[model samples]
Target: MFAILIKIKAMRVLRITFFLFINAFYANAQYDFEKYPSIEYKDYDWETVKSDDGVTHKVIVPDFYINSESLILKINYYTEEAKDSEIYISGIKYKEDIPYTPIGLSSLRIADVNGDGLKDIKIISYYMGNGLASLNVKVIYFFQQANGGFIKIAYEDKMGDNRLERDFDGDGNFEIITMKIQGHKNHNYWLFNIYNFVNGKIENVNSKENYPIMVQILNRETFKITSKLSRQEMKQYQVNNLENYNN
Candidate 1:
């Protein structure tokens, strides 16, 4: 009887030890940006600028491109009086590039879009061809402070005119919306993409078809499909007044 009791206690200890081992391994397995292969930190031209909110930012434009069609922007964050934190953002051109005309960073905007009290970064960059074949891209990086550094939690990209963020659900959080003019210039239609921050990341909450001129209501919890206008029905409505449209 004594021997059996001792063996049972030993088995219980082994089970608890195994459980802890698994949890420790998983905690360390999370993505580490420093060790990531696709990201590299090299010498680059750095500029220091102060935003309207009085925060100092060190913008680093990489001297060389790790990938030909992509541009990496490494920004260091600082207080109104001191320089201290860092955030890295990158944008890639989807379409084939036109040779000789390199893509460049055109503009940058710093603001708090998510209502999370942290300042976010918005980049507007363009690639030019011979006037007709040019492409303009916009990228937004949302920041979250973790582990003594500011990390990019969400990213949204659009190959269109401009990027807009609004509180679509009236829930205090912002939703990123982008409008892309598809098809040829003569018979083109607008394609709108909506993204919401959910589950610690950005998620698409719209269908792939054209939506009608109706209010889109998103469920704040699930982030699942609630309702949207179908492509077939959207064709019947005509949008004549552009100024009245909610961007």
Candidate 2:
């Protein structure tokens, strides 16, 4: 009789949990996406910039850079001061205004980030407070268009221990691994944010994906991860894999 009673109680608990999950999902689904900001795009002549390079002295903020056969990036780097950068790709007549770069500039690279044949761009930059709690990390992506231009998307997360661009699954694709931490006074709640380019746009595709492969790769690579799961939790879980995440 006791066994039957325990089984009945277990079923009741499961039913309650199931209903709670369904209700939560419904509430989340009702949240309007219009409340959020759309993706940002940088308007410029990429063709000329792709084949240009040089140095110019500026009394103001300058386009300090890394050059490759396909692109000359002026990371628009600055710190402790507000400034604007004008990028004149070597001999090109056109100039584009790159936004004021953060003081937490980490690294930038060009590669086929979205699994597309064309090379894409990724930037990892972050700022922090005196303690572990104050983190403002940004992961930015510029998914290349077939016309040789790029679509820009930026995401924020707290855990940024692994700053290098890596294809954690070894499947010819790379993922932007970030995380979100909540709670007060170190009683933290973590959400793992896994991002990739899906159909020329950056999207979070955590569900319907093999997360273990990434965790295993990080373990093998010996990454120091604080927020174990990841960063921002989005409802639209995309499913795009990357390969050889490099520039």
Please tell me which predicted candidate would have the highest lDDT against the true structure. Answer: 2
**For candidate 2, lDDT tens digit of each residue in 130-221?**
56545655555666666645666655556454333345455555656554544433444333445656675555555534332212122122
Q: Which residues of candidate 1, in runs, are more than 4 Å off?
A: 1-103, 130-132, 146-162, 183-186, 207-247
Off-target runs (Cα >4 Å) in candidate 2 are 1-68, 77-103, 163-171, 184-186, 210-247
Candidate 1 local lDDT, 145-210, one digit each (tens): 322123343222334432345555555456556544443224333444555555556565444223
Worst 10 residues of 2 by lDDT: 212-221
* Model 1 lDDT-worst window of ten: 32-41
lDDT of 2: 0.44
lDDT of every model, 2 decimals: 0.41, 0.44
